[model samples]
Target chain A: MSSADLRAISQLDEASRKDIAQWVENEMAQAKLRSTIHNFTEICFRKCVTSIGTQTLAKTEELCLQNCLNRFLDTNSAIVKLIQEQNK
Target chain B: MAFFGKDSEASSTQTQDVKQRVMQEAAQELAVADVTELINNMTKVCYDLCFPNPGPILTSADSKCTEQCSKKFMAAWNIISQTYASRLRQ
Candidate 1:
């Protein structure tokens, strides 16, 4: 039988066994999340920095950039929250 | 590396039997695309910030200024990301 068949059977006939499968899937999902955060940070850093020297980020620039990142996340969360809030 | 088991039979069992394991791969792909979109948005703003004057539109073998500008812009983006995330965590 195909693997799908095995999975279907496992879900229905072998409930206890399915617990292991669920845990593995969640771990994979978490790994994906970690990588995503890393990738975004890497590129965002590249676009923001202008000068070649190791000078510290200026206060105004730092605040603005920080705002940029937070606002982006906020926008995403707000959109979803608003959608659900409105729909429900 | 973790997936590779003692034998072929064991490895297949790890890969095929676990439905949850697939979620990691899906999450990775989604994150990659999300990051790309973020970079694109940030760059547009940076380009405008750096090059207020409508200079040459950046060809591959272009002027030195264009190269320098691109580098600095990326640096700003990085700073913003680090500063922003750290501040939020605080």
Candidate 2:
């Protein structure tokens, strides 16, 4: 974010500035998604791939990784739901 | 004598070009940053997985394990990306 040249954006015309704003918003969302995936991958990799046996992931290891991701999301939602209930 | 409109038109076009270039540069910078972060995380995760004991130098076996661990890490990333994207869509 600090690397970006904000001065250039300010010099743009109104229309061009609006276009850039929309494009940047989309890009930021995508970037957030990518970072989230990176975090989830690190977590699941540690949990699932306990040992490094081969270059390729074993069947169980792959399944475990997928399940770990799904369950993690489920857990996230469940916690949010619990918080909402507590507030109400 | 009536070149004022044409002058403004050219300036607008120039502005458009500048905007496009700025967007491209910003996008490239962000992409590079993302890759750097990913590599940093991978290094930490794989190093711990591959080298349980600290040795003076990396042996061939440890090197191979590091390679495999990186591959598995990337695979896990792909799976998570796909799963998360689909879930977001749903």
Candidate 3:
């Protein structure tokens, strides 16, 4: 939003201002979620689907995509945990 | 405070209308951004998978491979979305 938009929002009543703030927060969270999913899908697709022989994914390919997503998340948390432990 | 102030009431309504319009615009902008990212990512990934080598002209086989690659890419996206959502719920 522009600074002018911010000034307009600030002119709103307290309740209206709170509602708008909440909505903006929700929109931001949703955008982040979408971006994460998009990145994951691209990464897993590249790793699992080596060949595009058919319109439908092969059984192994589907399983690999699922496994790839799960492992990526697992790796994320595992690294976070190790970092937290080191800080302690 | 003037509970019956005509000017106050009119301005309040205007404020509400403005708020609604801004929210709607923000929602639409976010949706468009998400779709733009999806299309760009799809094009890059599918192009790499379907066309490993550049050709002087597009061939039927290349076209067919591109079609199949796009479909499979969507399938992968759906599966990944579901898996990610479920994991978040857990």
Query: Cα lDDT of all candidates, in order?
Result: 0.53, 0.81, 0.86
TM-score of 2: 0.89
Say which prediction, candidate 1 or candidate 2, comes out ahead on TM-score. 2
Instruction: List, residue by residue over A10-86, the lDDT tens digit for candidate 2.
Output: 55556666787788889998888888888899999899998997888888988898899899999999999999999
Q: Pick the candidate with the highest DockQ.
A: 3
Ranking 1 against 3 by lDDT, winner: 3
- Over B5-47, each residue of candidate 1 has an lDDT whose tens digit, in order, gives 2222324445454434444454566567666765565456445
- Displacement of residue A44 (Cα, Å) in model 3 is 0.4
lDDT of 3 by residue, A1-88 (tens): 5555565676667667778878888999989998999999999999999998899999999999999999999999999999999999
Per-residue lDDT of model 2, residues B8-74, tens digit only: 2227776777677777887998899799989998999998888888799979999889889888888
State the weakest 10-residue window (summed lDDT) of model 3 chain A.
A1-10
Poorest 10 consecutive residues of model 3 chain B by lDDT?
Answer: B1-10
lDDT of 3 by residue, B2-89 (tens): 1111222227877888688779888888999999999999999989987888789999999899889889989999999999999999
Docking class of 3: medium
Q: List the candidates' TM-scores in order.
A: 0.38, 0.89, 0.87
Number of the predicted model whose lDDT against the real structure is largest: 3
Identify the runs in model 1 with alpha carbons over 4 angstroms from their true place.
A1-59, B1-62, B87-90
